[model samples]
Target: MTANKIIFYPDNKEINVDQGTGILEAAIMAGVHINSPCGGKGVCGKCKVRIKQGRVETKTVGLLTKDEIDNGFVLACGSISLTDVEIDIPTSSSISREQILTQEAKVEHMEGIISRLDAGDSEGKEVFIHTPLVRKLHLTIPLPSLDDHTSDLERVYREINKLTGLEDISTKLSTIRLIPEILRDNNWQVTAIIGDGKLLSLEAGNTSHRNFGLAIDVGTTTVVVSLIDLNTGMIIDTEASYNRQAHYGADVITRIIFSRNKQGLDKLHQLIIETINDLILALINGHQIQQNDITAVTCAGNTTMLHLLLSITPSHIRLEPYIPVVNGMPLINADETGIKINPHGLVACLPHVASFVGADITSGVLASGMYQSDEVSMLIDIGTNGEIVIGNKDWLVCCASSAGPAFEGGGIKAGIRAMEGAIQRVEIDPMDYTVRYNTISEVKPIGVCGSGLIDTLTEMLRARIIDQSGNINESIPSKRIRETENGLEFVLVWKEDSGTLLDIVITQSDISNLIFSKGAIYTACVVLAGKIGFDINDIERIYIAGGFGNYLNIEKSIMIGLLPDIDRDRYKFIGNSSLTGARFCLLSDKAMKIAEEIASKMTYIELSADVSYMYEYTGALFLPHTDMGRFPSVQL
Candidate 1:
């Protein structure tokens, strides 16, 4: 096998790969980020790059234009290095880390929960004690004499029992071997790390104050890791980045399909592990914390993500019956899963309700306090899949809709992730059909993101550039609204004003994709509520979770029918509730228990099996709905 050197321009980074390696694979090896929403299968033309120098063999040009092909543009996923190659990764195809979504909303509520747990207040109910998944206790064992000498391990266990009131603690033989040396060298005083009824490790002297844990949210698109101080339940720092498993696929179904290929599961698992390890390393290094001091990690993610994280086969998850390997995962050592934390540190994943209704939803339910609410509340997490949960203190029901990745910038003509320079907001004047837009970080516009797409659809509808059926109204007569070879498109930004120096337009096809995405989400909410014989408007509150949900304009979302049309006050944004729930479980044993109970109590309604789902989904395909009576608030 011949190894060829590939150089990526602008960054000037280079790597050596086998001669037949795909340009996308070579870039991955070089630690370069490229947008491949279809996971380097050449189905999506997002991995475009210019052949700056040397020979390359391309299997397909994909969506590249004739001019682009003439100018050396080829899909990186489809091109392989025939010789030493120099590739120019375009700005539009590069992934940016500057604006990754990490900030969470509803901080005061989380703070209140923490305060209540710390004060042991349950409002006349069972108190959720502040027992973190991992705890460190400093103990001074009385010196062992022959007259009353218990075995060294038993002596340590006795002291632990006295301190923690836990009688049946267990530990590994390796930890038992270290007890004698650790206890004697520290003059009979040592700190014991206990996690999930087991002694994880023993350290000399008082290391109790240095205890830390990680709360992780592994989304299909992004991975967030938060370092927390176990003693105080304070979040030290958080770091987030695009999930590298995205190199394989954009959604769980695609990844699940890929996992059936040779070593595909291993590859996906390794990519996610690497992504998590990198984030964990960033958090630990930034805070000057030792890896050993971080004793536990609590993870919350969709079922597929959790499966990939634990190296479990997820093929069954997307099969006919849609069964998962396990909805309730057992606690295991972090090293067993290749997470780069303390070797003996424990890892716990929040429970899942079903194949699609995963731990992320359970975590959201816990974080929203919807399960304990007296009034009915709804929780919707908008991503590649739209997960909806509706119920109150007495009951809960959930269903997942395959909303696709249109919201996350997949399957759109001029779409990208919500990163710096991506257009995130838009407005159009009805008088002249002129457009106004705001990019993330106020930088030069590169492309449109989920929120920007939603805003664009709403503004276009308001400006009458597009009708309710998501068809472009060409008769409006504006230079921005022009017919291209692909179809009619409405330009949001001219090439001169764009960061990529390309006109960013929303095509008729993009409009249709957005409509389908919104329809799926809206229909899921309606169907789930209707399943329980309740109207969507009957819910007292709607809590929106996930990073994409955080930036959503409630008015625009309802206008486009992505969200249900209800009282504006009923909507509340609880950003990244999955991560929040993971943090709660990490900090409170009672929260973890509650998460499990929520998973078990909730009933999963499979929408695909429902006979009325298609009927309701078809009705929702139009702006708001074909049934105008359902969207009285959207009087367009």
Candidate 2:
């Protein structure tokens, strides 16, 4: 195959690829990101690019309109370049980092946890202990004499033992070689960097106050990093961005399939590392901190994400008997994992519960303090995979359901992620069937996001524009309700009101997809509760974790059967608990221990093996539920 030159406009990036290569692959090589939720299988029409001057062969148009095809628009994943090409990627098809939710939600309960630690109460102080994963201790060595001469290593260990009251301590040969010079040059004064029962480095003078660490949340869609002052247990700065590995897939299962390709696992691993490193660079640069000062990093993510972060093969996770490579990871050196921090810095990950229910849920359980409570509670993290945990200090159970990417804007027409031009709220007038909506960043609407989709479904139900089965009411007297070649569709935004200058409609098929997604989540929660001899209503409190939960409307979510129809007051949102838990672990070793306990104590229930799952899932496919008695609050 001969190489052909390809140029992408606006970005002005160029790359050469073998002839007949997919345009999507060329864009990836050229450092351009085009949204492909279907992972280049050509099912999603999102990877649209306009050909300015090129010879290309498109295998299938898929979702592209005839008008779009006539205008030289082609699906980047489906098109193959026969000769040199010049393609332009539209803003609607490009991924942006401006709106990735990096900040955790503000909740009184979460603040109370921090306040208790800050106040230094007896129990709180003892539990947290301010024992960071890495610590810098300033020590003064006794001056050596002819009568009491000892090796520099022994002298240093003797002082450390006396200070920490610990008998066992260790160090590397590299640090041992520098002890004589580091001790004598500083006049018997040094700051020792210790972690995991070993000395990492020794610095001259009192450098204890400069110690820093990172708390990382390696989410499937986004990556967040928080730089913290390990000495004082304070966050210095935070940064986040979209995971660049999304070029391969939108969800873990798809990524696992992609991993079977040649060098696919390595490519995914490198992409995630690049994303984290970029965020690390931004955080350190903004705070004027040195890379070497970051003595440790604590991470929280799903099983597949953690596996990919450490470059481990996760092929078995999606297969039968679905077992992960390691549910509980051991402490590793930062350099070994290619994380850009101190070379001797330690890296730690929160433990996982099962193949699908992973550290993110364990971290959530820890951050929510549910495992320590006497009353039963439920924790839910909604994404492509919906993880549910229910328990108290006495018992715990968890399950994960493959809810698909409908909530994150996949497999739906006119759907997108939570970005700057996305519609995130919707309302409809029951009298005239008119629609009102709000876009993120106050920009013109491009597409509906998860929250907005939920709002739309609820509003449609309330206004009777859609039936209980999510069927569009074509009999309604409104222009917004019309039939397309695909199916009956409801226009949320007219072409004139849209940033893309195209009508954004929610089709009947999109409604069914969302119903299936919501049904899977709701059914999983119910089944998990049933396995423990409980009901959904028996959960005294429900803690919602994740970025999606931060903006989600409880009323709308319940109305759509995505959540149980419990009392609204029983619901509490603990945003980004995974990151919060990582931060806690970075600041206190006790927190890390508790997180491991949470992972170990959890009893995982595999839903696939349960006979009642499909039967119960069928009942949840309708609005609210097929059994109206389950949703007493929803009167419609």
Cα lDDT listed for each candidate: 0.87, 0.87
**Candidate 2, which segments miss by more than 4 Å at Cα?**
1-5, 16-19, 52-55, 82-86, 101-116, 120-127
TM-score of 2: 0.95
* Stretches of model 1 off by over 4 angstroms after superposition: 1-3, 101-116, 119-127
Candidate RMSDs in order: 2.4, 2.5
- In candidate 1 the C-alpha lDDT for residue 491 amounts to 89
lDDT for residue 218 in candidate 2, whole number 0-100: 91
Q: After superposition, how far is residue 130 of candidate 1 from its true place, in Å?
A: 1.2
lDDT of 2 by residue, 442-545 (tens): 88998888899999999999999999999999999999999877889998988888887678889999999999999999999999999989989999999998
Q: Looking at candidate 1, what is the lDDT of residue 524?
A: 89
